[model samples]
Target: MIKFSGRGLLLDIEGTTASVAFVYDVMFPFVRRELDAYLQAAWKTPALEPVLRYIAQDAGADTFAAWTQDDATEQAKQQRVSAEITRLMDNDIKATGLKQLQGLIWKSGFDSGELVAAVFDDVPPALVRWNEAGKDVRIYSSGSVAAQKMFFGHTNHGDLLASFRGHYDTTTGPKKEAASYRVIASDYGCDASEILFLSDIVAELDAAREAGMQTGLCYRVGNAPVENGNGHPGIESFDQVSIG
Candidate 1:
């Protein structure tokens, strides 16, 4: 029954509001299955050229400006892009470019009714309670801000985007760094002590604590049965939290 009084609620997605399995099983597999075809179909357009450039930059293929500029014939270029994208996915690199591309792919899946974002049962009600109480709720995750919105906006509970104040991603800073939490606190124009941060990762909770925010570790059913070895408060669900 650990409790903290704060006007701002900060949340981590994976292993917190949503099951990590949904990400690893549904989202990652969807991107892997669809990326090559999507790239092949989109290469001719100006819209995808910039995205390809970002992917190529991360792949270390510096001279591969875009699909249109690849040295080989178009067929070979498709093969190269597909291979590079596959290699990155296989390695599970959390590169910003790859994440952005995955989010784009997921947008298609969500729009086509092939994918539905998952949220824990306790989450939506907690979000609504917090909003009604006038507490500012924000998301901070490794997923890009756009991806985070897409996820919340399409969850089974219906659009939860209106419940959020804003979002943060790795672009703001690394999750395990205290400076990042400080930045978010500053961005919200509040003292870190006024924010309560919830995540499944101990290091992230440690970072948030260092930033002067209250912290909790989410211990969902699918997560490891590890003890709260880091001394942070442990919660099994949002039902255990209160903003007001």
Candidate 2:
């Protein structure tokens, strides 16, 4: 068991609190299946406008309108966005725009009961324990903040959103960068040493440790094997972590 005495907890979703397979096998396929239809229906709406702009910017253009200046029709512009989305997905690129768009699409699925987040059994109770103990808990993930909210709000264990105090995504900064953890600590209103960052990736743990946060390497069943933990303590369940 890994015992950590900290005032805050920053968690990673995939392969940590939730299975990586649930993301790659379920959530991702859901996005691909609903992509074109969602874009077609949401085109030019207020909701999609900023997302498209971000996508355009990610593609090295200033705006969606500027990117598709030669497309000559709404359909063509949408098709361009769809194609770019497909390319990003195919390459497993974690672009901000792609994550935002996926979050939007996931909203419908989650609201309609078509999708449910798969968190580990130990997670829900641990969240409650930490919250009750006055440990500020938050999430840092590649998934957008909106997506993270929706995910925790609709997990199979049910409405775990109340446990989290804040959310961070790539918009804050890359997960593997020490600067991002420093920013999270500042935003979370705690000294970096007061937070415990838990993730399945050693690189992320290394980054958080570099930023002065305590770190734990999660060892979930479906997570990729970590040949070297690089000195981070390993825990197979949240129960092992005792936040004071």
Candidate 3:
């Protein structure tokens, strides 16, 4: 067991508790392949306008507005959005607006039993163990809060949402920035030192550490390999972690 002292646990999703392959291989492809279909289906839905607007805004107001002009058919708008979303995915930019919109689209897939989240076998148990021990557990993923909840709700281990206190996404601010961890600590009404952050990325751990939070580098099998663990205690399983 790894020695730790903290009041709560902070977690990264992809490459931490879940397989990176699930995100890069499965989720990204699913979103890319289904983007056009989802856009076409939601074309007339008023709720979809905000998501479309964000896509346009991110792409370029003048160009996208021209694409959305009166003479431009719904199909043209969708084609543009789909192409732009594909570009974002290819570049792997974590845009808040795009992330939320993708969460909405993924919701449909989850509801239809078409998508299932692949959680590590050790995650659910460790979550329960830590939570039961009175340690608060929460997630901080690049994915939206809704998307995080969706994945946990549909995980192979069954509903694990109850094991978490809250979720954080890019909306909280960029993960590689120390200020974001400070903000999260303030929001949680705790000192940064009270939270232990677990992630597969050294830069993220470095950020958390800079904010005075304890950090651990998760080195799970099939996760993207790291050249060095940056001197943080490495965890192969959530079982290795303890917040006490």
- Best candidate, TM-score: 2
How many clashes (backbone atoms < 3 Å, residues ≥3 apart in a chain or on different chains) does model 2 have?
Answer: 0
Candidate achieving the largest lDDT:
2
| lDDT, candidate 1, at 130 | 83
Candidate 2's residue-wise lDDT over 1-244, tens digit each?
Answer: 7676778999999999999999999899999999999999998799999999889999999987889999988888888988999999999898999999999999999999999999999999999899889889999999999999999999999999989999999999998999999999999887999999999999999999999999999999989989999999999999999765
Cand. 2 Cα-lDDT = 0.94
lDDT of 3 at 102: 86
Off by over 4 Å in 1: 44-46, 57-71, 74-78
Model 3 Cα lDDT, one tens digit per residue, 1-244? 5677778889999999899998888888888778777887787688777666666666666444654786367677677677777778888988766787788888887888788999999998888789778887889988989999999999878888888898999879899999999989888789999889999999999999999998999888897779988888898998887556
lDDT of 3 at 107: 88
Model 1 C-alpha lDDT per residue in residues 118-222, reported as the tens digit of each score: 999999998888888888899999887888999998998998899999999877888999999999999989899999999999999999999999998999978
Clashes of 3: 0
* lDDT computed for candidate 1: 0.84
The weakest ten consecutive residues by lDDT in model 2 span 1-10
lDDT of 1 at 136: 89
**What's the lDDT for residue 69 in model 3?**
82
Model 1 worst lDDT window (10 residues): 63-72
lDDT to native, each model: 0.84, 0.94, 0.84
Count of clashes in candidate 1: 0
